[model samples]
Target: MKLTLRTVGVFTLCLLLTACSLPRGAGIEQEITAGANDADADFAMYPVTRDFLPTLAEWPVVGEPELNWITASAGARTQIINPGDVVAITIWDSNDNSLLAAPGQRAVNLEEMRVAANGTIFMPYIGDTRISGLTPQAARARLQSELEAIVPSAQVQLAMAAGMHSSVDLVGGVNAPGTYPMPDQSYSVLSLISQGGGVSGALRNPQIRLMRHGQLYGTSIARLYSEPHLDTRLVGGDRVIVEEDRRYFLSLGAAGIQDQHAFPQDVVTALDAMSIIGGVSSSRADPEGILILREYPASALRTGQRGPRQERVVFTLDLTTSDGLFSARNFRIQSGDLVLATESPVSSVQTVFSLFGSAFGLVNAVTN
Candidate 1:
C-alpha cells in the first residue's frame, strides 16, 4: 500500500512538470505593446471602453436606400408608349368610293401600322402622323380630327399592342425565374416576385437584388416583407435577382457551441449573438474574459483611436461587470467576427487535481 501511494504521487508530479513546460501563445499585452516589431505583432487588442464602443457600432450599418412599395403600386399608369408597338385603326365611313372606304362598305378596316423611327405612321389622307407617345384613347382622338375633313362623318377607333419593351427580369434562386411583362405600369417589386414563383424555400437567407439604371440595390426578402415600403416599384429594364446571403461570424474557444453562424436579421447586437449559439459553457467559460476578435480598415480608424494603425483589431469584455453587460447590449456584431469566451483558470486547476485523484484511486484499488 505504501509503494502504491508513492507511485501515484510520482505520476501526479510528472503531470504538473509537463504542463508548466509548454510554450504560451502571445496575449493581449503583446498586441498593444508599442515600439514592437510589426512582423511579430499580428493584431491589435482593445479593451471594452465607452470611447471604443462607437467603432464597433459603425461596422454593421451598410446604409441602405429605402424603397416604398405602396407608393409605387398606388400611382396611376402612365400613358406614354414606346417603339416596336403595333397599332390598329378602324373607320366608319358614311359613303363608299372614298380613298379609305371600299365599294358598298359602311365600315372600313385600316391596315395595322407599325410606328417608325420618327414616332410617326402614314395614312391615306394624313401623312406622317406621330402617335408613339400617346395612349390608344388619346391617339384615336388625335387621328379622328386629322380625317374629319376628308372623310366627313367618319368615326375612328384605335388600339395599341404592347411589345417586349416593357418587361422586368427575375434571375436566379427562384422556382420559375423568367422575364415578366408589365402591361400595366402599376407592377410593384412584390408583384414581379410573385409572378416568378417567389424565392425558393431551399435557399437559406435569400436576398433580393434590384438593378436599375446601371446601379445595383438589394435587401433580404424577409426584411422586405417585414417593411412594406422596401418592396419598391419595378420599372422596365429592371433586373431582380434572388440569391443566398453569404455573411457569417465564427464562435470559438469556450463557447457552448463552436461554429460559424450567419446573420439572422439586418442588425444583430453582441448580446443577441451570444444567445444564438446557446451562450457560453456554464462550467468552463470565464464570464469576465469574453473577447471579440474583429478586423477593420485602417482608413476607418478615428484620429484619436487608442489602437494600432493597422486593420487587425480585438475587443475584450467582462460580462461580470454591469458596464460590460450594458455595453454588450448595444455593441453590434459584424460579419467574419470571432466571439471567444476564455476558459476559467480555476477550471484548469480543477482538471489537474481530477487527474491526480483518478491516479490515486486506481493505485489503491490495485493494492487492495
Candidate 2:
C-alpha cells in the first residue's frame, strides 16, 4: 500500500482519539456512574412498595415502654451443648447400708467424653446409655431409674462440671485476633466478638460471619446483637470469621477533591457518592470525560478455579446528563474497588509550561 497524506491524517486522528480515551483508573469511575444512573432510574420509575408502613403520628420516636419490655423478654437464650463436655454425676442412696456406711464418698470425674458416632456414653455402672438429646436434669432422672433397679431407694445427681468448650476463630480488623474458647457456651454472637476484643477503629460495622464447612450460617452481627433470639449457638466445628469493612470507593485524579470515602451498607444513591468527592472540580475535572474502571481478580477472569468463582464485571459511566450524573451513587462498591476521576483537557497547560522551562534550561546550558 502506498503512503499518502489522507491515510496519514486518518492514522493521526485515530491515535489522538485513543490518547483521549480515559486511563485504566478512570474506567472504574465511568462504570460506577453508569450503574448508578441505571439503578436510580429503575428505582424512581418503580418506587418500592412494602407490605407494611409505619405512621409517625401513631408511633412515638422513643417507642412504647410495653413494646420495648416485650421485645427484651422475647429474646430467647440458645444452649450450645456439644461432645467432649466435662460433666459431673453424683449418686446417693438412703436405704442401701453399704453405700451409706461407706467410710468415704468418692466422686467419679468423667472428664469431657467425646460424643461417640452413635451418640451414647458408657459410664462406670451404667451400660451404653443415650445422653445426647437429654438435658442435664433429664439425664440424671434416667440414671437414677436405671441404678434403682440394681439398688432400691437410690438418689442420683447429674450436672455439667464445666460448660461446653468449642474453638471459635476470629480474624481481620480486631485488636486481639485468634481462636477463642467459647466455654460457658451460649448463643450470644456478641459475647464471642467481645472475647476477640472487637473490630479495629478504621473499620465500621465489621462483618462477623459464622461459617461451617465453607457455608455461611446465621445472621449478621447487627441483626444477631439487636435481636438476641437470632444469635444462634456456635456448634463444635463452627468457624467465626471477622472480616475488615471494604464497602467504600476511592475518587482520585482531577475531581474537586481526591480521597477514599465510605458508602452506606444498605443502599447508596449516586448523588450520595458525588457529594463525598466534593462535587467534582470544575477547573481541572473533565465533565465530559468522567470514567469508571473496575479491576477483577485474575483468577476470576480464568475458567474453573477450585473454590468459589469470582465475578469480574467492568462497565462505564458518563456524567454529561443531569440525571445520569446524579445516579452514580446508586451503584454499590464491591470489596477492593478502585474509583478514579479524570482530568480536564486544560490539564495539558501544565505540560506546555514544563516544556518551556526545559527549553530555557537548554539555552542556559548551551551558553555556558
Candidate 3:
C-alpha cells in the first residue's frame, strides 16, 4: 500500500512538471507576448485604453482603400441639349410658295437631325445653327425666327431625344443595370439608382462608386440614405457602380467563432467586433487578454506621433476592467485585423488538477 501511494505521488509530480507542455487550443497571453519587450522585437505592442485612443487615431488608416466623395449640388431641372442629342423639327408655312413646305403641304417634318460635335445642326438654308446648349422650347423659338425670313408665316416645333453622350451608366449591383438617359441636369445618383432599381438586397452593406472622366468617388449606401444632402447630382457620361462591401476581418484561437467576418457597417469598434465574432469562449478565453493583430504597410511606419512604430502591431485589451471595456468600445477595428482571444493560464492548471484528482480516486478505490 505504501509503494502504490508513492507511485501515485510520483506520477502526479510528473504531470505538474510537464504541465507547461500540455496541449491547448490557444497560447496563453504571456506565451504570445513573451518576446515583445525584447529590443529587437519585430512587432510593437500597445495597451488599448482611454489614453492610447488619441494616439492610435493619429496613426494612418490601413487595410481599406482611401477614397473621396463629392457633395450634392443643385442643378436646373430642365433638359439641355448635348452634342449627341437627336432633334426633330416641324415647320408650318401658309405661303403657297414656301421654301420649307411644298405647294399642297402645310407642314414640313425634319426627322433624325443629330446634333454635331460642335453643338450645331445643319438646316437646308439656315446652315449650321448652334442648338446644343439650348432647351427644346428655346431652340424651337430660335429656329422659327430664322425660318420666318424665307417664309413670313413659318412656325417651328422641336423635340429632342437624349443620345449616348447625354446618358449615365448603371454598371452593377442594381436590379436593372444599363445606360439611362439623363432627363435633366437635376438627375441624381439616387434617381439613377431608382430608375435602374434600388441596390440589390443580397448585397451586404452596399457601397456606391462613381467614375467620372477617369476620377473615382466612393461612399456607402447607408450614409447616402441617411444624409439627403450627400445625394450628388449625376452628370452625363458618368459611370456609377454599386457593390457589396469587401472589407473583412478574421478571428482565431479561443474566440467563440473563428472565421472571417465582413464589416457590418462603416465603422466597427472592438466591442462591435467581439460581438460579431460571437465574443470569446467563456470557458477557455482569458477576458484580460483579447489581442488585435494588425499589419500596416512599410510606408505606414514612421518616427513620428502620427504613425505606427513598427509595421506589425498588437493591441491588447482587458475586458475585465472598466477602463478596458470603455476603451474597447471606442477602439475601431480596421479591415484585415485579427481578433485573437488568448487562453487563460489557470485553464491548464485546472486541467492538470483534474488528472491528479482521477489518480487520487483510483488509489482510494484500491485501498478500499
Best by lDDT: 3
Q: Compose the digit string of candidate 2's lDDT tens values, residues 339-362.
A: 446655565454445555665565
Q: Which is superior by lDDT, 1 or 3?
A: 3
TM-scores, each model vs. reference:
0.78, 0.57, 0.96
Candidate 1: segments with Cα more than 4 A from true spot: 4-9, 18-40, 49-51, 58-74, 84-94, 101-124, 301-308, 363-368
Q: For model 3, what is the error of residue 292's alpha carbon versus the real structure, in angstroms, after optimal superposition?
A: 0.7
Q: Candidate 3: minimum summed lDDT over ten consecutive residues — where? A: 1-10
Once model 2 is optimally superposed onto the true structure by TM-score, how far is the C-alpha of residue 13 displaced, in angstroms? 22
Q: Best-fitting candidate, measured by TM-score?
A: 3
Pairwise TM-score winner, candidates 1 and 3: 3
- Residue 28's lDDT in candidate 3: 87
Give the C-alpha lDDT of model 3: 0.90
Report the C-alpha displacement of residue 53, candidate 3, in angstroms: 1.1
Rank the candidate models, highest lDDT first.
3, 1, 2
- TM-score order of candidates, top first: 3, 1, 2
TM-score of 1: 0.78
lDDT (CA) per prediction: 0.72, 0.51, 0.90
Tens digits of per-residue lDDT, candidate 1, 225-265, equal: 88887667777668888888767888887787789998777
